[model samples]
Target: MVDADQTFVIVGGGLAGAKAAETLRAEGFSGRVILICDERDHPYERPPLSKGYLLGKEERDSVFVHEPAWYAQNDVELHLGQTVDRIDRTAKTVRFGDDGTLVHYDKLLLATGAEPRRLDIPGTDLAGVHHLRRLAHAERLKGVLGALGRDNGHIVIAGAGWIGLEVAAAARTYGAEVTVIGTRPTPLHSVLGPELGNVFGELHREHGVRFSFGTRLTEIVGQDGMVLAVRTDDGEEHPAHAVLAAIGAAPRTGLAEASGLEIADRAYGGGIVVDERLRTSDPDIHAAGDVASFPFALFGTRIRVDHWANALNSGPAAARAMLGKEVTYDRVPYFFTDQYDLGMEYSGWAPPGSYDEVVIRGDAGKREFIAFWVKEGRVLAGMNVNVWDVTEPIQNLIRSAAPVDLEALADPHVPLESLVA
Candidate 1:
């Protein structure tokens, strides 16, 4: 039984924090709910930041999780633009940066999220260099992209992950010369494997995007304190009006560390360690979203997923756990990405070097396919590219863990449901 009068303080005002607050209210917890956000805006979805929002296809209001009126209606307190300085577990209080207000909580949820990884290379502090982790960053980059539409601008993107690739597509759509620099031989090689990665590389190449693969960015050259060009280890200088560093993101766990919560080691991506129920070492404190590295029952390993779906689902799971409800965060991990005309939806966990074989079901050249990663004759993970309305079957196959007929799985004529049946 939850103490209805106890206060619940949720840190980090991203999708996870918003969803947790919603869950608490939906679960009939008439308690004091306070959401602390470092950003000025309320919680909003981030997927559109790189795609629709950057491309000017979507409006600003559509990205928000809830309008201002929803908070007032639900009786949820919003403390925006306030950074949590420290967490004193002994006092059950969290110190804020703005005016140094110390707020107490009977239960706390840390959704501090992650920050964009910054490069130590030269000229990174220059005016036109950008990193897109927040809406503010996206807004700044959107301005640069707008300039590209009017002028003959060149954008040099560092790293070949999802953000870098999506931005490359968006910049190309706006008639900018895009150059992507990556350490891997192919973009997203580690996650999607080289075969599927080459397909994306081909997609970008078709749109006139250049790739300097298997190279490192040594410096970002600037003129008048604004980005002008980038120097790669291959001794080549690529001229650019803007630079985007999308190498990766590091989990924001300083408060969790200061409060003596158990954190995963570097091997597990250095996030807050949580159990199946999303409870940290201290039962009073819980974690969710990108910050929580919890045990994944299906994969038999601890993993932290940094994607929209995880943040959306884990928030409620953590909230339920906090209320002493019997729950298990066992949802299959899912993520999706859109680039140019290509859209992909992937589900289940197939960690690098874990899958034994990959079976493709459609033509990679046509950019329509479903790829499955199998281990020990069981379907571990599956990805559908440019295919719609089949995620349910793919997820069902993964959950069943049944041995599949390779011929039937590869045949487009066979309905995915029949294979599982």
Candidate 2:
């Protein structure tokens, strides 16, 4: 059990780390809470970095998890711009990079999160090439693409995932010519399936964003240290003033690996292995957010989710577990995104090839619909696009896990609440 007088250390200053500090204070923990972060800024949310924040609709101050004064007010120590050299797990100390400072902790939480995956194409290091994983990256992109009018600048995005698509929409709103290249035929098809993925693709196409499906980026062409275009495996080159490589992210697990924590099996993306309670192999340490590959009770499998909701929910759960409380972090996975006029909320988990059929309740062509992925008549997952106020019903359907009538589920007249009834 963690004593109130002992020090508690949290690594990484993302949403997970901020929430852990919030929870500790709320739980009346008087221990010294030190938050070590590589970024100089206080903990802030990342979703807006791509959408509203990048588009200039949201202010910088609004994205922060808490004001800078909150940490001081709550007695949480802020260690900004410090790189963690190593975790001396045997000695229960975290060594700093520059000055060799050792911060001792009776209990530790690892929320190092994940880093954006980089493309290894020839000109990836060019000046106009960018990746979006931090505020600094988004700021750089805003400087490059913010003021361009329609067709004034050509922007090539190398991935069709959520980040790529969201930035595409934002760039389009600024009137830039955008082209998205993806190995998959449709954007988000792996998660939402081809039917819904096609909806997103068509939506983008209608707004003048081009697509190069089933192609791989072979090289980023450049001269004078600035990107000029991208060449694909299909022998086609697309002109570009700026390029964004939104090819997804990989869990930052180097600290866990070095500290000898059990790395999750490769099947689970090789993150730090944790139980349902978010406890790592060592009782004195715990990991949450994207770095922890935890056993998900609802899906009956181990998984690591790199979404905003998981980080928001799991951070507090890990804090409670670290306090020696018996708790299970069993909340269903959820995530939401906004691109162009389309807004979507998805709940539950059903990986690609897991669901046998997708049931639609509204007009997909019109962009207002609720889609459900069912396996053996049980609703494994559901998503509502541009459809509001039914998230509770969708979540309830997934939690119940009861077989539903396909005809009724597909009928718009049938209230979602009645399907589970």
Q: Best candidate, lDDT-wise? A: 1
Pairs that collide in candidate 1 are none
lDDT of 1 by residue, 1-421 (tens): 3355789999999999999999999998888899999999889989999999989999988999988899879988889898998988889999997788899999999999999999999899899889998999988899898898679799999999899999999999888999999999899877887757888999999999999999989999987898889999999999999999999989999999988889999787789999999999988999999899989777788888889999999999999999999989988889999998999999998766888888899987898999999888778989999989999999999888778898888899999999884
lDDT of 1 at 223: 77
Instruction: Give Cα distance to truth, residue 383, candidate 1, Å.
Output: 0.9
Tens-place lDDT digits, model 2, residues 342-389: 999998888788889899999988889999999999899999999999
Question: Pairing residues by index, what is the TM-score of model 1?
Answer: 0.97
lDDT of each: 0.91, 0.90
Please give each candidate's TM-score. 0.97, 0.97
Error of 1 at 374 (Å): 1.5
Candidate 2 lowest-lDDT run of ten: 142-151
